[model samples]
Target: MKTNKLILIFCLIFSVHSFAQPKMEEKKEQIRALKVGFITNELKLTADEATKFWPLYNAYDDKQFELRHQKMKAFKGRMEADLDKMSEKEAAALLAQMESNEDELYQIRKKFVTSLKGILPSVKIIKLKKAEDDFNKKLLEQYRNKGPRR
Candidate 1:
């Protein structure tokens, strides 16, 4: 029918237009893909496990990012404030903030680990933790070798 033909044309145009839009979301997707690559290799996930693991991992990562962003904002704000002048009060506040951020990060990690354990075997959970540590170590080394940020 003509109506069906028109509907198909509209759908095609919409799909094309969507794809034509800017790839602003691509950076997030690339980072996510890199994370999955790291996890998949480290965990040695089987196809069936991967199917379940990625979705859960993504959810866990999103929550971690939320917590981290909050801590980062607070830390950066304090550091900016301290640039003009430093005082014992400022130092104490920064120390407390840093400690709180560490605690929050630890708590977030614990929650993610618990959730992951519910979905994965103990060995896989251990692997995930090791992978995270290894990733952090490598990232730190890279930054150290690169010198100060521009």
Candidate 2:
């Protein structure tokens, strides 16, 4: 009887812990959508710009997406593992990878901005930068208000 009670307790605890953790794929999708929102707001793109921008944007996004996946693939299952348990070396390595990924993103943005400038007005370029900043600020506010993922 005591053994059965212990098993039940264990199962209950496991169930609660599982429910408490946010699913990785769900978080990825949410972030992806948020990024899309930023892109839209930042561009404040007109109908004509939208027609031109989207195709190019899609290509750029795809490239960035590939880079992210490539970086993540390097770490494999270790990302899901507990951060607290990671060794200093592991953590440092991860940070370096993150920095490299960030640099790549910056380069991609620079290239795309040049592309946009060729087809867009200087005024629109300023608006696009402002829009991007505003979108990021909003996302930060929302995330902070909501607290950490469940």
Candidate 3:
């Protein structure tokens, strides 16, 4: 009877986790849609410009997302390590790895902006950056105002 209860508990936990994963992905999709609309409106993209812009922008966004995921994973691993017991050499290496990740993120941004120069006016590209910042700020403000999730 005890073994059966343990099995049931494990199954329940697994099912809940599976359900939660889809909901998390759904929320990500919704936010992505909202960002697209926000950016489109902010840029005042013409149909021709949007046709040329979104593909390049989406590719750049995907690369940035992947790099951020890698950086966060590395950060989490470092957090889990016993820093007090770590050697100077190991700590230096981790610091170097963190710096390298940041440099790579910067390089990707530089390349994306350079590519945008060919597709957009400098003024519009600057506006794109502002729009991105504004969207992020608004999203953060909304999240903060909502308070902590239960």
Best by lDDT: 3
Tens-digit lDDT track for model 2 on 1-150? 343344445544554454355887665555555555455545555667778877876788788788878776877677878988999998998888888888998999899888988778888777776866776687677669767764
Q: Which pairs clash inside model 2?
A: none
Query: Model 2 segments beyond 4 Å from truth?
Result: 1-43, 65-103
Off by over 4 Å in 3: 1-22
Taking all chains together, each candidate's TM-score versus the true structure is 0.63, 0.52, 0.81
TM-score (C-alpha) between model 2 and the true structure: 0.52
Q: In order, how many clashes per candidate?
A: 0, 0, 0
* Per-model lDDT: 0.70, 0.70, 0.79
* Model 3: lDDT of residue 106: 95
Give the TM-score (vs. native) of candidate 1. Answer: 0.63
Deviation in Å, model 3, residue 97 alpha carbon: 0.8
Whole-model lDDT, candidate 1?
0.70
Put the candidates in TM-score order, highest first. 3, 1, 2
